[model samples]
Target: MMTSQTTTNGRLSKRVQEIKPSGIRRFFDLASKMENIISLGVGEPDFVTPWNVREASISSLERGFTAYSANAGIIELRREIAAYMDRRFSVQYDPEQEILVTVGASEAIDIGMRAILDEGDEVIIVEPSFVSYAPLVQMAGGVPVAVGTKIEDDFKVSAEQIEAAITPKTKVIMLSFPNNPTGTTMNAAEMHGIAALAERYDLLVFSDEIYAELSYDADHVSFASLAGMKERTILISGFSKAFAMTGWRLGFVLAPPDLLAAMLKIHQYSLMCAPTMAQYGALEALQSGMDDVERMKQSYKQRRNFVVKSFAEIGLECHIPGGAFYAFPSIASTGLSSEQFAEKLLLEERVAVVPGHVFGEGGEGHIRCSYATSMENLEQAVKRINRLLERL
Candidate 1:
């Protein structure tokens, strides 16, 4: 579909006109229509919502708890979320003022940007990161200045890079640790450097920690938990990744009260509240799903091992990702670009993976393969990918 950029009249906002479609969706859509496709392209967890969580939502429905919740979400869910934060990450928030539930982390990201940014305010987006980040910043009337990280660096953005990217108009740092596409988490030293930069520059941080619960080799660090950071950071996370509740469409933000109040104004008008039943389900997840999270994480770790080993067997250099369920392997030696390798692999071997070039910057010449599927699918896809590499 053509964007509003090509509209008959000048009705669309220039900011909206400037945004590009998500790169992740294109391959997912193409793979959806094809048969015999073993897709490691999508980053969704293969697990279903746990029985306890689903039952909670069903029970809520049975009790006729189907009304518009307060815009910040049902107090119970928010309170549970607050408790979970303190328990899991040593971070605390006031459920009454610091948290606002939204449709998903996606919405929280957008509204968080909108609430904080004025026209031409700059947001430093590190890459190869999530595809939606830069577009969201631009749609919020902010300039998305991209800084890239390298494979040797384990895809972690260094303080020097962030400092170099910042300018007089720089106002926000968009951070996604256990990052999508690359699946790397930050070390304490890295975090300390970034926190120092943010503190010294007085920059606000928009931290997306959706994959926080999926870390493998290292523990996930909450940016807001850093000293001198809680007040300046707005963190977004949800049940989608850890609790396998993607279709439930629920997530929330943790920010200082005043900032949350501003985002809430935008959220209440646009979304009203997160899905009531979804919030109930999420509340259940926070209350009793730790065992389920551990199970899913173990499964992902197993799959990650297989993917990393298979890439090595094919003579592709792939760093073992510290967290999340993805492995980004370089396709440079194959004499094919990331897109060319992905497309040709799908056509020739019926194995689908995301071209890293779609993620921009350091992503070029690499491809992202998600191990969030079953062991069976992961093995088959890797075998097929290896075969394609051999033939090439």
Candidate 2:
């Protein structure tokens, strides 16, 4: 079934050719060549990894810890992660059998999809989601069916929307709370509705809660914590956002023993194990980094308030994001597409933001601005954005 049309010079695979590059990276690449650019494009945190966490890694290396861990991960790290889950989100896992350490949440997503999706299987993904979800599904031979959520609904996909998209081929539902690009969060009551549907349909759920600790209003409710839902949910989270450890490239997955075993098989052959020192660093973070996380979260909350208010003053309507550090303000009034707005802003004002359409449906006419940078940068960026609107 390999068609000549799907090949590039009879070389590249069809799937590889069809997948587009990340829109966020494209803008960052364009901005990188220019000087004095204030970029809000990448979702990385501005904070450094806390001194205690960094020191732990350094100490481990000093003591000769530069070796591959067990295929699952170092036992101590897995046990700590299990305890963190119980205390933080009320979900419990058996570290020895039900947890996996991955290169990043990105890798976890990839391996998780590959492990579960047979060719032609369907996964219902919530739209305006992280860029990786659909493409990863395609690469794994699963059809990604996207369900669009509205800003009017605070960008939270409802049970009804997901149910409507499901068919006999549907096998999984993917969710990201404290959603990327939108910075929205759903409460316990709202999550229960989706959980109910999953139970009814007997579908698996992938809940990406990487930004859970960044929530502003209510505590985050893990999808697995709902009654009878733990067995059916794959909970993915990491230290990237909350602990400011993006460079460490470590993330973990919690699932039922059966599902975990399948993903572990993929992980074992491909990655072997995460870096040894990074696992030690993560253990320190879990044991001592809560105060640091709290401080960073509070700073983000202040930045979020300022960004939303500044957008309002400039006449750009935005939802008050409940969590995470992104503010998606509608740019439709400026008479430009989201891509046009982002390009012009970068060219004319030296400020970079991601176009909303890149995040998929229900995302046009808006742009995503990250408040993860310093307050000074945020203020300057706001001024430049205002100038662009005025000129338009």
Candidate 3:
């Protein structure tokens, strides 16, 4: 498919060229064109956005709230976000000065890094985590130092490891409890240690709590809610995972006054405000959406139990995740590299699960299986995995 003309077609910036494509996306693209593919790869919820949430957007359109309201987004949505945080996490933020709506948590991640990092600044990220953290740091011109978390630690990041990784150049500690890929969560006592470390090092913290509402039989201790951490932590969450509003492209960042202003400056020029109708949908979700969240959470809980139990029954050791909708099961027992196991399973069973190494080095012997789908799919994927494991 390649020719000399193609090779010479265009030049990419060194920054762009140096970065590798996302590990999570490769399998996604491959699965898209395949027949009868049962994917446990993508992380979005299988549930449709609730009718009430859709109605809210439709009502907003009927009322002609089509124009972009403010660069900071509409005051009403911001106020609802502030209230929701206080009510749910006990973290108080000023709607006017402390919160900025973003185009999904993805943009919040980018702007948060861009607003603060200078050349050569270092950020410590715990892995295996969401695929974007390290890449975002690099794109923002900061060095990303990954601290690997183990299954024995319940994948809760260790403050000691984080402290050991910090350098004089280190500026931010990015937290992703109810973490992606691993579905791990930290309790209050565990989080206090991380908070203490941040205090000792005087590091800024960015906590992505988009999965806060998805915890199962575990309390999600928000880094921002910990003692003396609010001033230093930028808490980012959105309606995507919990409210089933991923396509709405709505997310928000909460920070102290000065940091919020800096990120807002970048956001204003970059994304303008998030989509007006989407904001309305998010506002409705935040206001009356807890019921839908609870409904989905219950469904995920049932699926989680199913997948974890199924994996165990078939001789695969799976860490029982406390939050989020994924189960990161170790595939080391099969004596196959994560990639090989995933590829073989896909070819043999027509099932798609992400190979863990794509998440980072820590994920090499594991695979991340999302339970955010129908119970029937979960059952079928388990059966397929069981068949493959038996043969191996």
Candidate 4:
């Protein structure tokens, strides 16, 4: 656990030292210090939390309700979450025994990895993916085996690809559809292939559906909803993206009772529970925030179309993103690596984007541009990107 190498400040854990800082934040931070930079680096929504959800939290404070609930979360929130899952994703869980709310989806993923992984256990992560999966697996004493997908396949990792990576040491399959950097979504028929693989290998699955509510071309098929998968699946989602409540820091996990018990042990020891007020806000969100979510989804759809078309016009080959608010456009024609393109674009055009290589295999020679900002910003960023491409 300890490392021989020491910094002037102090010694750090070997595990901590090996993990690189998030690539998404490096450009975002640099852009923050500069003047008039249009950053598409961070994957957060630009929308504010709905007023009703905010007011519910305010009302809870006014009523002097500020104490930790049961480590699993408040019964009301958990019940609402269970109902929401059943209605929205066609999955069901017992609120009292199967759901645990955490600080955010990040915490949910971290604790879920810790709950299931033993030393040397392997997790088959589909990439290019959200940046945290491999590092979190490593942190929890598991190995991360990446299964890269091609843009030609619409960035969907096939069951065959996943099967090829499985071994006797494999324990879990981590998935994120309506994916972070690529914005690709696999339909029910496509996901059934992976579900069959999970069943065949007797492996657990961590289904990250944080972007589930934002699918544009089709309804999101929750992996757990597929036959026989619910028993072995850990479902992670939250109010952050759909409800535009990222600052609220609320997320929930659902699994079978026994598996939830294991994750709850980690939640109780490190983080006692999610924020009290945020839970109240989330409760209100589940109750009456569908309309707000719909409005935001419409806006994102519009922005997604604009970005994709703009990229095509500018000679960047971007696959049409099916969901989420990101556009991954190939920058190979410019003869620059993803990092080079992102850095040069930032410095030359004042438009910041995340280098796709940071998202892992199959991400090089491309860049991830988030369409989560306003259309005006998106247009200006595209124009700047076009200007840079012309110069190149």
Candidate 5:
């Protein structure tokens, strides 16, 4: 065999080059190498996929359902998702024309942005949000306009803020609740106000409600449920957070027919469909996994109480998060930056947490701790964090 040298003149896409890696990954990467490091870093449920959901996937594989599904998704799964949405949120979506299955809510975010955004179009993202939204917007040739939500305001983006952020170039308002990183959620009234703002501004709303099933104090309100909002909102949700099926990589989006068609085209070109077996599993989850979802929610609720109480006892300022598995505590008393506090906690106490700033500038002087770990682990992690704080 002769040795050959290969050279390429092609350049990588400028959009991709400008996108930065997620800051949440940094703590996880470091924690992986440390001995006995108690990680409250990643925003993932600690529970396994329920046995019934797993069995459904097993049954699909046994039946040799390993082939590709429709570019949108299996019809039965979409119908089940539609039914589930109607039953749970009273949001009716036509599965046949308004829904598309995605590899995950992550992909739904990407494709939704890709379908609607033109170069320099602005997307108002409420921060601190999941790390992916802004970069994904940038990669889709859109400008990410972050509206900072403060702890003083319970991290909820107000309608007034949304109105102020709207420019003539604004094409979308990307909102998430039961939010990641902050564990905040919006009520129906709050969401209605946002929908009104979006409608007034003539902007599409990309609502990420992936944590819809995990709320503790109140029900998750879908912006798409508001009257007149459905026509302009693309709702993205999935089985990952609620059903403990993160590894399954199944998610779906519900939108108007025209937008669905556009997103489906991009989804088809980028990802043929969500994984076949995962789609089957999600179908089962939507139909028969209500009990499983409730059980996980209760567990998370208990953990949330424990973590919040423990942090409060130690004089750390934290709110009782209404949804999701995270506790965002202010680190102002320690006089350390979010990143510095996270680093010191990891290095000194072998406890891992993500800095608030990792989420966005609004996250300064704060840190996010996930109570997704077992109660015992959460207690120990809290103790360790308290000890670290006292030494400061």
Candidate 6:
């Protein structure tokens, strides 16, 4: 096998070379090989795809519907997504002109950034967030300007911060909520403020709401649903988080017709379309899997409570996450840096959590622990973590 160093291409793209491996991947890789390791590292849901959704994919295969879909994705799926968005969130998007299904939410982010950014443009990223946003921006020749959300503020980014970060070269505000890593979400007021700021600055917004259906106590607000913001916001979401369909790799992007056209050009040249079977599965999910979605959300909510309470008892300052499956807890009192704490926990206690600093600079004193594992695993991990803290 040719090595990366000895490959015929000789040199990798500067963008590819500059990108670091995801921090979340590192702990999971190490933990996976260890006996009795309790991993709260990966962000994927533990639930299997709902039987109905799986049957839809199986049905598609039986019908031989296994070819390249339209570059913009199946029209019926897009229409279903549009209807779901409208019914669930009151967001209006024309299925034909506004939606493009992609390989995953990850691809939607990549295509959205590539379609709008020119060299040297700046994208405002609210951090500590999902690991991909900044690197993706760099790859597209755009600069990522990270705005740190404070723990004191429940990890919500304010309009004042957004206004402060805007420069003449600012092209987009990349927003994620309920966010990964932090598991924090913005309320209607906060989202409206961001929408207002985007309008005031004449900036495009890329809102990642993959966790929209996973909010525990509160409702998830879509930036694109705000008045006037829909025209400027590219909304990214998927079946992975809410429907436990991470392996399905089906997601969609919604934007104005002009923006969708530009993104379709890139999607066509690059990915062609999302997986056909996954698209069919997602179609079934949106149309008939509401009960399944609710079941998964309720399970996550129970897990969230268990983890949060356990962390609190362990003297870790866990900001009760309003959404998503991860818990962000302050580990500063451990007298260990986030990386040090994560490494030590994995090595000694056989519990895996991601270092907060891996998400961004402001994430230094905290760590992200996912509650996506079995309740049995979570209980044991908590016991081990408590013992580790006592020893420290």
Model 2 weakest lDDT span, ten residues long: 1-10
Pairs in clash, predicted candidate 3: none
RMSD of 2: 2.1
Candidate 3, 1-392: lDDT as tens digits: 78875675455566666688997787888788889989999899999999999999999999999998788889999999999998988999999999999999999999999999998999999999899999899999999999998887778787889999989999999989798999998888888888898899899999999999999996667888888999999999998998998888889999999999999999988878899999999889989999999999999999999899989899888889988899999999999999999999888998999999988899989999998888888888999999999899
* lDDT for model 4: 0.93
Per-residue lDDT of model 5, residues 89-203, tens digit only: 9999998999999988999999999999999999999999888988999988999999999988999988999889889999999998988889999898877778888778888
Candidate 1, 1-392: lDDT as tens digits: 66665564377676676677777788888888889999888778888999999999999999999999999999999999999999898999999999999998999999999999999999998899888888888888899898998888888888999999999999999899889889889866779999999999999999999999998887788999999899999999998888999898888899999999999999989989888888888888898899999999998898888889888987999888988788999999999999999989888888889999888777999999988888888888878887888798
Displacement of residue 387 (Cα, Å) in model 6 is 0.9
Report the Cα lDDT for candidate 2.
Answer: 0.93
Note the Cα lDDT for every prediction shown: 0.90, 0.93, 0.91, 0.93, 0.90, 0.91
Clashes of each: 0, 0, 0, 0, 0, 0
Cα deviation of 123 in candidate 6 (Å)?
Answer: 0.4
**Tens digit of per-residue lDDT, candidate 6, span 1-392:** 88877683467777777789888788888888899788888889998999999999999999999999898999999999999999998998898899999998999999889999999999999999889999999999999999998888989889999889999999999898998888898888877888888888899999999999999988888888788988989999998999999988888999999999999999999988888989999999999999989988999999999999999998999888999899999989989999999999999999999999999997889999989999999999999999889999
Give the alpha carbon lDDT tens digit for every residue of 1-392 in model 2.
Answer: 76676464478777877898988888999999999999998799999999999999999999998888999899999999999999999999999999999998998999999999999999998989899999999999999998998777878888889899989999999999989989999988988889988999999999999999999999998999999999999999998999999999999999999999999999999999998999999999999999999999999999999999999999999999999889999998998999999999999999999999999877888999999999999999999999989999
Quote the positional error of residue 14 for candidate 2 in Å: 0.8
Candidate 5 Cα errors over 4 Å, as ranges: 1-10
Error of 6 at 46 (Å): 0.7
TM-score of 4: 0.98
lDDT comparing candidate 5 with the true structure: 0.90
Q: Tell me how far the alpha carbon of residue 266 in candidate 1 is from the true structure, in angstroms, after superposition.
A: 0.4
